[model samples]
Target: MDIVEAVKTRRSIRRYEPRDVPKEIIVEILQLALNAPSAGNRQPWRIHVVRDYRLKELLTDAAGGQMFIMEAPWVICVVAVPEESASRYGERGRSLYCIQDTAALITHILLLARNYGLDTCWVGAFDEKKVAEVLNLPVGHRCVAIIPIGYAGEPRKDRPRKSLSEIAVFHE
Candidate 1:
């Protein structure tokens, strides 16, 4: 799908079919997602692809019983390594730039998944400490998002969006 189409149609799919997304396709999407721009090209993101049923159950619990996490065949945890960015740009890089960079990477993953006829949900409402422990994240690294990816179990309807005037500001 084209970028515009993907942007318009993408939804936070909460239900997934009982089918598997091929490993090659998942790797291809990750490869493309890495092209997302990073601050100072530091690429402060690390992706953890979780397919284990026990791990998914733990993730679901970490996300406060968001059961859809277990329905998808794959869950992707996007991690941010602040120290990597901080090495080049100092405190601001650690606090802000790394987060922004990983957010961009997450966006790439969502859109690229849609391009491959896969469905995903950008799940961010999880206990950070719990997720860190569940994923065995290194010290100072953070899990920015938990994405459940697979084929959709049901169709999604477009939700309402704010108009450009309500959300945008023109400087010139």
Candidate 2:
């Protein structure tokens, strides 16, 4: 699907079919995510693709018992290493710039999943410390989000959204 269609149709898939998501597809999706712009090309994000059932359970527990994580065939943990970013903007680059860059990568992954006939849920409700421990993330890396990817088990309806006129303000 095209970008516009994908953006309109993509939804947080909570239920998934009992199927496997191949490593190659996951890698390609991650590669697309890496294509996102970063401050000074630091590329401070690290993606950990988890397919193990036990680790998935741990992630579900880390996410306050969100069972959909365990049900999905794959869970991608997006991590940000602030210290790895360029210090041109000083502390702001470490905190703000790196975080924004990582979030952009996550957005890319989500959209590309839809284009590839797959679905994912943006999970930011998890306990970061627990997630880091579960994934054994390297030092100075923080778990920004946990995305569960798979084929949808059921249909999803579009959620309510504010109109552009209501959200956007024009100064000129």
Candidate 3:
């Protein structure tokens, strides 16, 4: 699908088929995510792809018992490396751009996955400290989102979004 179509169709897929996604496919999707622009070109985002069912179940529990994470074939943990951002932008940069940049990269990954006939869900509601422990993240790396990816078990319905006029404004 084209970019516009992909953006329009991409939804947070909560239910996934009990099928495995190829390693190469996941790699390609991550590469696409890496293409996202970052503050000062620091590329402060890191991704942890979790495929083990047992670990996924553990992560699901850490993510507030979201069972869908365990059902999906794969989960990706997006993290913000503050040092990378700080090196380029200073203290304020670490606190601000690092997280936003990581989020943007994850958005790119989600869109690319959708374009590739895959489904993904970006999970932000989770215990950051627990997630860091679960993933064994290093210090200064903060967990931003947990994404579960696979083929859709159920069809996606349109989610209500604010109209452009309601969300956008023009300066006179």
Candidate 4:
């Protein structure tokens, strides 16, 4: 699907069918994700693909009992490496830039998933400490999003959107 169409149709899919996603498709998504834009091209993001049943359950528990997360056939943990950018941008890079980069990567994942006929939900509501423990993340890297990807079980309507003037500002 074209990028515009994908952006128009992409939805935060909560329900999924009982089917496993092909590894090739996941790889494609990862490729697209890695190509996402980052400040200074730092690309300080590491993604962990979680398919193990036990681990998914642990993740759901860690995420304040969000049951829908476990329903997807696959989960991608988007991790941010603040230290990767800290050398050049200092505290701001570590605290903010890395997060922005990771979010960009997640945006790519969301769009690419739709392009590949898959669905996903951007999961940010989770316990960061528990996530780090569950995934055994490195010291400087932190979990930013835990997205569940799969085929949509049912159609979902767009949530809603604000007016352009309310969201955008004129600079010139």
Candidate 5:
């Protein structure tokens, strides 16, 4: 699908079909997503691809019992290593640049999944400490987003969006 179509069609799919997404496809998506620009090419993100049922259950609990996380065959945890960017850009890199870079990467993953006829939800409501423990994250690594990816079992209605004029600023 084209970028415009992908953006328009992408939704926070909570219901998933009982089917599996090919491993290669998932890898390909991640590989392409890595191309997302980073602050000074530090690539402060680390992706944890979770397919184990037990781990998914743990993640569901960490996410305040978001059971849809278990329904999807795969859960991707986007980790941000602030130090990676901080090494070059100092405090601002740790506080902002890493987050901005990871957000870009997350957007790429979501749109790329849509291009593959898959659905995904960008889940951020979770216990950060619990997620870090569950995923065995390294020191200074933070879990920024938990994405559940799969084939959609239900249709999603479009959510309302603000008008361009309402959200955009003009200088010219």
Candidate 6:
């Protein structure tokens, strides 16, 4: 699908079917995710693909019983490696663009997945410590987002969004 079409149609999907996503498709999504731009070309992100049902259940608990985390066929944990930036840009880096870059990439991945006929919900509220433990995240890495992906269970209706004039400014 065209990028514009995908962006307009993509919505936060909360319900999913009980089918499994193909391995190749998952790989494709990850590939697109890594293509996201970063500061000074230093990509500092690691993704954890959680497919185990037991682990998914644990994630739901960590997310305060969002429940949909367990229903989706796949959950991905996006982790940011801040050290990658600190080593290159020094003290200025940690206070800089690493988090924003990682976030942009995740957003790109979600849009790409939506275009591929998959659905996702970006989960930002969760127990970081539990997520780190469950995903076995390495030291110095922070969990940035938890995304649930699968076939969307319900047809989407557009959510309320601000008008263009309200959010955008014209520069002369």
lDDT of each: 0.96, 0.90, 0.90, 0.93, 0.96, 0.88
* Inter-residue clash pairs, candidate 2: none
TM-score of each: 0.98, 0.96, 0.96, 0.96, 0.98, 0.95
Candidate 6 lDDT tens digits, 1-172: 9999889989998899888889789899898778899999988788889899999998898899998889888898888888888889886666566788789888988998888899999999999999888888888788889999999988877999999999999999
On the 0 to 100 scale, the lDDT of residue 117 in model 6 is 90
Off by over 4 Å in 1: none
Best by TM-score: 5
TM-score of candidate 6 against the unseen true structure: 0.95
Instruction: List ranges where model 3 is wrong by over 4 Å.
Output: none
| Clash pairs (backbone) in predicted model 3 | none
lDDT of 2 by residue, 95-143 (tens): 7888999999999999999989999999999899899999998878999
Error of 1 at 139 (Å): 0.5
Candidate 4 ranges beyond 4 A from true positions: none
Off-target runs (Cα >4 Å) in candidate 5 are none
Measured on C-alpha atoms, candidate 6 has an lDDT of: 0.88
Q: What is the lDDT of candidate 5?
A: 0.96
lDDT of 4: 0.93
Show model 6 residue runs off by greater than 4 Å.
none
Of the two candidates 4 and 5, the one with more favorable TM-score, higher being better, is: 5
lDDT of 5 at 25: 95
Candidate 4: the clashing residue pairs are none
